[model samples]
Target: MEIREIFAHNLRALRKTKGLSQEELAHEAGLDRTYISSLERQIYGASIDVVDRIAKGLAVEAADLLRCPEAEATK
Candidate 1:
């Protein structure tokens, strides 16, 4: 899968795991709700700085967000 898609999947999974809604995650990440929604839908590509902000909001390492379990296992 594409990196953006992987990131979107991971972001949604993590956000749900943390029991946070898109609005709540956006608020915590200092981003707009629609932007967060777009990111989760793989409609937006985030910069490294934005990735860091998202990781901080999810309370996870930036690397964790980029790690795709299935892909990583193959590598």
Candidate 2:
């Protein structure tokens, strides 16, 4: 998979772990629901600022949004 796909996967996992729906997460992150959906689907790329906002909203470090923990194991 591409790096973007891996990021989307990690984001999805983290969101689920936090028990947040896409809409809820979008609202909390000050993003649009469609945009959030696109991000989760790897259809849209996120800027660093956007990632920071999402990480902050989810109470995670910014690296948590950009880094793939499982991918590290696979590598």
Candidate 3:
């Protein structure tokens, strides 16, 4: 998979593990629910600023949001 796809898949996995819905995660990430859904579906590449926001909202380090073969979020 592409780096973006890995990141998106990992993001969705993390959110589910936290027992949060797309709406809840988006709210926490200061984003729109559709946006999160789109991201998880790998419809777009998230910017660094948005990734930072998502990391903070998820209470995780920014590095934790990156995917492997890149930064190391996804396996």
Candidate 4:
């Protein structure tokens, strides 16, 4: 999958795992709810700064958001 797809999938999974709604994650990330929805829906690509902000919001490493799902399955 593409990087954008990986990031989107990871973001959604992580957000759900943390019991956060899109609005909540957006708040935690200091971003707008629509922007968060756009990211999750793959309507926009996240820059490095945004990735860092999201990682911080999720309390995870930025790399975690970029990991390929198939690769993660083996670990």
Give the whole-model CA lDDT for all candidates, comma-separated.
0.92, 0.84, 0.82, 0.94
Could you give the candidate ranking by TM-score, starting with the highest? 4, 1, 2, 3
Residue 32 C-alpha lDDT in model 1 = 92
Model 1 C-alpha lDDT per residue in residues 1-75, reported as the tens digit of each score: 889989998999999999999999999999999999999888878998999999999999999999886877799
Backbone clashes, candidate 1: 0
Write out the backbone clash pairs for model 1: none
lDDT of 2 by residue, 1-75 (tens): 676787688788899999999899999999898888898888977888988888877899988777767777899
Task: Mark the 10 consecutive residues where model 2 has the least summed lDDT.
Answer: 64-73
Tens-place lDDT digits, model 4, residues 1-75:
988899999999999999999999999999999998899899988999999999999999999999899897989
TM, every model: 0.91, 0.86, 0.84, 0.95
Best by lDDT: 4
List ranges where model 2 is wrong by over 4 Å.
72-75
User: Could you tell me which 10 consecutive residues in candidate 4 have the lowest summed lDDT?
Assistant: 66-75
Candidate 3 residue lDDT tens string, 1-75: 687877797788778878889898889988999999899988989998988988877888777767554454354
Clashing pairs in 2: none
State the displacement of the C-alpha of residue 70, model 1, in Å, after optimal TM-score superposition. 1.1
Residue 68 displacement in candidate 4 (angstroms): 0.5
Candidate 3's displacement at residue 48, Å, is 0.5
Please estimate how well model 1 matches the true structure, expressed as its whole-model Cα lDDT. Answer: 0.92
